[model samples]
Target: MKAARIHAYGDADQIRVEDAPIPAIGPDDVLIRTVAASVNPVDWKIRRGYLEKMLPYDMPLTLGWDVSGIVEAIGADVTTFKPGDAVYSRPDIRRNGTYAEYVAVRAREVALKPTTISHVEAASLPLVSITAWEALITTAGLQPGQRVLIHAGAGGVGSIAIQLAKAKGAHVTATASQGKTALVRSLGADEVVDYHNPTAFAAARDMDIVFDTIGGDTQDASWAMLKPGGFLVSITAPPSAERALAEGKRVGFVFIDPNAAILRDLAQLVDGGKIRPLIGGEFRLDDAAKAQLASETGRTTGKIVIYTGQP
Candidate 1:
């Protein structure tokens, strides 16, 4: 199978298309005939060896994290899906990824793709959706009728975070460019704060939770928005626990685990028309370098995906 892989960790030029052996399935895994995969920030981060210490894949790594495809075969213990089932997953980050024409994913992390959307759109949702899900729901323990502020509202995790927060009955305040207000509003953001403006902090106040996708000063200011005992969750980096405690807020840093239960919940939300993925752009499997460029440049609105099949 043809795959876009990185033999060395460096610039985008490091990714190359090569013919590699198809992925072999384990007893607990399924082999998916790839239709589409999405590029998350981690794809490029891992490609450049930024995450070498935390997640060390062997050299020549296939650098995609999300897949929406058809099951060509299933392992003996895989009873959740059958041959020819359409599925999607945020494959475990610890192994070879979904940049190939096919991927072998653990059955526990694969779920039935939502029938309401196309493969490209389905591909866009898994990683970011799971990340947002873990941040807003699992980590923060958000309750209905509360307020949650999400930084980087136009981003992959922020876009999904807005919708999931709204779905869970939280009033969401999201930070973005003034031009992106409509996009953020369309995603169910109750309040769209323009972070590009000089008065961004003055506009965002009194929140039950702060979901910061951008770390740094933006993350630090999120602490001020929270009332006493509110939650602060940052997916971009680990939270400063001492600072959080000083501000009288609970803080958490989330790392996504690709569980079928998480994907299944996201799938059901998609099926119910509560959450929709925002697809910024797409490239073919051979165009992974372009995808990496889009991610690093930070110009994309939401997810940038790689389609392995015809449009």
Candidate 2:
């Protein structure tokens, strides 16, 4: 099988598409013949060794977590899916991932692909959708009629977050550049704030929840936008516990823990026409490095997908 891997972490130049032995599965694993995968910021972050201490992956790692593929085989302990089943997952990041012709993922982490979309589009959903779902629904306990603000609304997680928040009947506000404001609004954001405009955030005040995808100055500024008891949820970094206490607000940091249950619910949303995956670009598996470079740019309107030319 051909896999794009990095033997040592560095730049996109270090990724090489080469032959690798097909992965062997454990008793609870499913062997998937990769159809498509998507690039997330974490893919490039892992490639650059930024997450070494947290993830501790071995060298020669295949760097992707978001996958949509056909099950080639399933472990003896796995009963939920069978050979030839189309499935999608944000697989556990500790293992070699879906940036290859084949990948082994835990059966419990896999869900049937959304029937409404192709594998390329399905591939774009798992990671970002799961992150958005967890942050908005699971962690924040966002309620209908509440106001919510999503940062980087044109980017991967934010794009999905906007739609999910709206599906939950929340009043959604989002931040994007001037050129992408229409895109964010189309995704169901009730208001789009141009992040480049210095005073743009003033219009976003009195939120019930603020989903922060960008850390540093952006996160710092978001605290002021929330109502006194509003929740600040971050996927980029942990919001300060002390700050939350001092400001009489709540904060939670989300590290995506793949859940097939959530994927199933997301699929239902897709099939029911409540949500959709947005593909910013597509690349051949051999061009995985290029995909990572595009994600690193932080300007993509949606997810970047990599199509593995496998039947």
Candidate 3:
């Protein structure tokens, strides 16, 4: 099988597509013939060795976790899916990843691909959608009729978060560049703030939740926007516990724990037309490095998908 791997972390240039042995599965895992995968910021971050302390991945790592593929074989204990089943997952990031012709993923992490979308679109959903679902629904416990603000509303996680929040009947506000406001609004954001305009979000106060995908100054600014006791969940970095205490707000950092149950629910939402993927670009598996570069630009309106050139 051909896989895109980095023997040593550095830049996108370090990625090479080359022949590698197909991974064997464990008793609780399934072997998937990769159809498509998507590039997230974490892909490039891992390539740059930014997550070494936390992940400690072995060298020659295949650098993709978001996958939509067909099951080629299943482990003896895996009963939920069978050979030839179409599946999607944000597979555990500790293993060799999906940027290859074949990948082995834990059966507990896999879900049937949403029937309403294509493989490329399904490939785009798992990671970002799971992150959003975990942040808003699981951690924040967002309620209907509440107001919430999502940063980077046109980016991968933010785009899905907006739709999910709206599906939960929340009043959604989002931040995007001036150029992408319309796209953000189309994703069900009730109000779109131009992020380039520093004062644009001043009026966005008394929110029940603030989903922060961008850290640093953006996270700093979001604190004042939330009402007292409201939640602020960040995927980028952990917010200050002391500050949250001082301000009488709740704060948490979300590191996605892949859940097949959430993926199942997200698929139902996708099929029910309550959510849809926003794809910014597509690349062949051989161009995995190029896909990472595009994600590194941090300007894509949605997810960047990579096709493995398989059926």
Candidate 4:
């Protein structure tokens, strides 16, 4: 099998495409012939050694979590999937990932790909959709008729978060550049704030929830916009406990734990035409390094996918 891996944690230069043995599966795993994989910020962060302390891994690691492909083989105990089944997953981050010709994923974390979208599109959803789901539904508990603010509305996570929140009948407001206002609104944001404007979020106060995909200054400013009991959910960094307490609000941080049930529900939404995968770019498998560099720019409006050339 051909895989893109890093022998050491460093820059994009460290990523190399080379020959590797096809991974063997556990009794509960399924071997997928990779059709596509998507790049996330976490991939570049891990490659740059920024997450070494938090997510320590041995050298020569494959660095993608999102995958969409065909099941080429299955292990003894894997009954939900079989050879030739189309599937997608945000695989466990502790093991080898989907940046290869094939990936071995636990059957429990895998879900059928939505029939409405292509493999590249399916590959883009797992990580970002799961992150958004965990942040909005699990952590913030967003409800119908509630107002919620999502930063980076045009981003991979924020784009989906906006749609999911709207699907649940929440009044969604998202922050993005003026150029992307139409894009965010099309994704179901009731209001779009021009992030370049210093007072962008000033009028968006008293929200029921705030899903922060961009931390630092944007997060700090969001505290004032929430209602007394509103929830502040973050995927980039942990919200300040002191600030939340003093402001009479709730704070939660999300580390995406892939769940098959949640993925199934998300698939329902996708298949029902309630949500769509946004693809910003696509690259061949061997261009993984370039893809990582592009993600590091933080300018993409949606997910960057790597097509693995599987039939």
Badly placed stretches (over 4 Å) of model 3 are none
lDDT (tens digit, per residue) of candidate 1 on 1-311: 98999898999999998998899899999999989999888888898899989986788788898999999999999888899899999988998899889899999989999999999999999888888888888889999999999888899888998999999999989988899999999999988888878687676888899998889888877777888999989888888888777778799988888877888888889999999989998888888899889999876799998887543
For model 4, state the Cα shift of residue 248 in Å: 1.0
Give the higher-lDDT candidate: 1 or 3.
3
If ranked by lDDT, best first, what sequence of candidates would result? 3, 2, 4, 1
Q: Deviation in angstroms for 33 in model 4?
A: 0.4
lDDT of 2 at 83: 99
Candidate 1's C-alpha runs over 4 A off are none
Q: Give the Å shift of residue 118 in candidate 2.
A: 0.2
lDDT of 4 by residue, 1-311 (tens): 89999999887999999998899999999999999999999998888999888888987898799999999999999899989899999999989889999999999999999888999899999999989998999888888899999999999999999999999999999999999999999998999999888776678799989988999998998898899999999998899999888889999999988788888998899999999999998899889999988899999988999988664
Looking at model 2, how many pairs of residues clash? 0
Clashing pairs in 3: none
- Preferred candidate (TM-score higher): 1 or 2: 2
Point out the higher-scoring one by TM-score: 1 or 4: 4
Colliding pairs, model 2: none
1 or 3, greater by TM-score:
3
Off by over 4 Å in 2: none
lDDT of each: 0.88, 0.93, 0.94, 0.91
Score every model by TM-score. 0.97, 0.98, 0.98, 0.98
Question: Worst ten-residue run, lDDT, model 4?
Answer: 195-204
Query: Candidate 2: worst 10 consecutive residues by lDDT?
Result: 195-204
